[model samples]
Target chain A: MPSDLPHSHGRRQFLKLGSSGLAVALIPVSAFAETDDMLAAQAELFGDRPVQTGRVSVDLPPIAENGFSVPINIQVDSPMTEDDYVSQIVILSPRNPLPVLAQYHLTPRNGLAAVSARIRLGGTQSIRVIAEMNDGTLWSGEKETLVTLAACVVL
Target chain B: MTTIRLSVPDTAERDEIIQIRAMIQHDMESGFRVGARGEFLPRDIITRFECFYNGDQVFAADFHPGVAANPFLEFHVRATDSGSFEFVWTDQHGEVWTDTASIQVS
Candidate 1:
């Protein structure tokens, strides 16, 4: 938070602003500004590795009646052998308050490379899925969801 | 205190793949809700979950506020031997909720 932000003001400083400033302070700061967290997440993880678009897919309802708990199924095409297995999978929501939803670490002991869970969606946005193989190869996939009732937003 | 629900196969064949499910009772407050007094609520949620097979970690997940409340997980594990599977979850405040299940392999 920047020092100029109203919420950073101390009680003494807030009192100095009087009634008009008090009202402004009461208004909570919200992230109305759009952010490209999807790109940010990829940069943080894979860096410059070219994200190949295949070998991974996500199953999600085309129209989410509610965004509170949208079910998502993730699949990765891997042999799950000791030599070549999916080591990690990162889920990202481009429009969510936090881009990185979760990172699942898998071992060859998993036998298969798939996961299912109910994840939250703030609104309509693309869900990005990235899989990292044991050998450092990265595969990617994406799907868009239409959220009727948005979550993670307050005005 | 928090309650945890775990689903592990009671029995399996050696080297067989088995599915495991775990759920935690939590509010998963995303910190985006505005209170009646018009203040934003602070985010409180489980930040991590790990599954250990016979004391060796086999699967783990790093969670964020984007996950739904009362987070549930479903994944697979190879039944290599008869042992115990321990599931543990840690919240942002460092509170932990854990449970264990035993499986038989023949």
Candidate 2:
């Protein structure tokens, strides 16, 4: 049946449908899925507000030799002016017993929305950072670290 | 008693962004471990930290077990005036440790 669509239209549809169908049939549990604690923490922090993933950078080593002390740095792209500024930054760990790794409150006086510090990881997992602006917008970024030695979770 | 080490430029130009680093001796007990008797240890980590430039709060952090022991933090601020920078830390046991450093801003 010849249609107005391009020749690759049918192939594109087939590929999309085939992959989605295979996903439903084969992968019942995906590691990419967010944990309940992570979801709840995000919900509590964002409160149904959309969190766009950009303008935030999370820098951590790809492989941490020890989970007890890993240096991490986070920066948010902001002018840090009086009218517009980054209000808060939160770090959450899904694998940790307590999802909250740390919370930082910033203001225009800070002149920059950046911080560096050392953190502990319970295991190899992704660490998420959320930045809230003074205008009520939220942006986020994440970094994954593989820890050779896992540490105890924070209860 | 916690030994607090703070570093800040002794002098800075007006409106220049100044970098500050602070470290303290802390065990940062996670309370996730058990003793020989199998009872969970009580949390003994720093609960809060705040940095004040002159007198206004410039930066602050709320800690959790995920922060490594002997907490070290580095942040920045714009020098608006010649004054002192004060760092305060409060632990889970309601103990507070504070240190101050002076900065000469031109």
Candidate 3:
């Protein structure tokens, strides 16, 4: 009976170890890892051009009660004239499953380089908006939102 | 056929800045969800939206899955002339939904 008890104890231990290993693999990777991948994908679109951090303003609540529909407004201080205007505006959410949320293409016909929409966020993360001027200059703005409830959770 | 709604001032002063709003009805399936039977749902979303004023593009957007369903967009456009504003939305399947609104400028 004593020899049989030892064999049962060893089997139990092996099962426990296997279950723990599976748990670790099931856990999602840290948000930072996802952000790095998103950044690399962004670089492919805009190149390694230095992103100037001004001339654009991002408006959003500091704390979002719901991540499913967070209202966002972006405004660029451009005159929207033929000589100088914003050609493109991009919104990126690093933590979201798809980082590039929206890309807006504007022309001088748009009297203002401003847009407003509702976007989804996976969690507390930084939202970046980049404005590309017709002169080939890029300007960006960033805002952080603490999401109490995440939207894109895998069931 | 999908129902589309567009909001623009029927009349405006010349060169006045007018707000343009458009909404389309569609499910923006993010392609990340699994069905009850454990089958992956393919992504189907409106990938592009374009607004043309008097045959010239005034604004456009490239949308991803992060955007919510029934996409709504608001932006500013200079009312230069009284012409038809054409709005077009293209989905992943190459299907296009279009609507037009006319504006009068004094």
Candidate 4:
């Protein structure tokens, strides 16, 4: 699939290294003042590919009375073998100050590419999941949720 | 750090579903207001959590700052075995906290 941003797609090839090492490229909040640069950086690392629709499933409660700890589950259909497998899974919150919340790297030894966790949301927004196959194919899924009580502020 | 409680059902009437409940104590700071003269409090939020059963992770999520303080989550597990389950939580500051609970089969 073709990437929406051509320049950003090329940057992803430079990042096929260690998954943990990619965290170093994440821009800090201070840099958010330059939203354009931040977007460019994010697109380079994340948006460079066309994410196939409906390849992954994300499950969450429809109405989260509280936001501090909302349950979430993600599962991808893959054989997960030594030769072909899911390399990474990324969770994105569109409205959060930092959209990229978590990234999980899996090897064939992991047995399954499914994960369940609790997440904090600032408000009601859409949560997006992007799954990257070992071959650089990106698949996406999204869900919109309503949160009653939000957390994560310094008061 | 607030106390956390987790419970797994003792037995399941069916083969596909098992109930699990989890609770944590915390005053999720919203970072919206200040104390006395307006001293901005520190932000202490759990950003992500995962559940591992028998070394295989069955659930995981990425949390944001908007979640309320002291969250409780409940869900079902596809009854596989009466093994141990582990929950790992990571706060906004990148600190990791973990708890373990075991399930018994009838």
Note the clash tally of each candidate. Answer: 0, 0, 0, 24
- Candidate 4: docking tier: incorrect
Candidate 2 lDDT by residue in tens digits, A42-74: 898788999999999999999998888999999
Q: What are the runs in model 2 whose C-alpha is more than 4 Å off?
A: A1-34, A153-155
> Considering DockQ, which of the candidate structures 2 and 3 is the better prediction for this target?
3
Candidate 3 C-alpha lDDT tens digits along A1-155: 46678878898899999999898878666765888867886797789988899999999899989887888999999999999999999998788877899999999989899999888888988899989999988999999999998877752
User: What is the alpha-carbon lDDT for the whole of candidate 3?
Assistant: 0.90
Off by over 4 Å in 1: A1-35
Q: Score the docking of each candidate (DockQ).
A: 0.53, 0.53, 0.59, 0.22
lDDT of 1 by residue, B1-106 (tens): 7778889999999999999999999989888888889898888999999999999999999988888989999999999999999999999989888899999999
TM-score of each: 0.85, 0.86, 0.86, 0.54
**Alpha carbon RMSD to native, model 1:** 11.9
Question: Comparing 1 and 3 by DockQ, which wins?
Answer: 3
Model 2's TM-score against the true structure: 0.86
Worst 10 residues of 3 chain A by lDDT: A24-33
What TM-scores does chain A show, candidate by candidate in order? 0.76, 0.77, 0.78, 0.70
Output the lDDT of residue B31, model 3: 86
lDDT of 1 by residue, A7-108 (tens): 657765767778777776685434223344578678888898988999998999999988989999999999999999999999988788778888999999
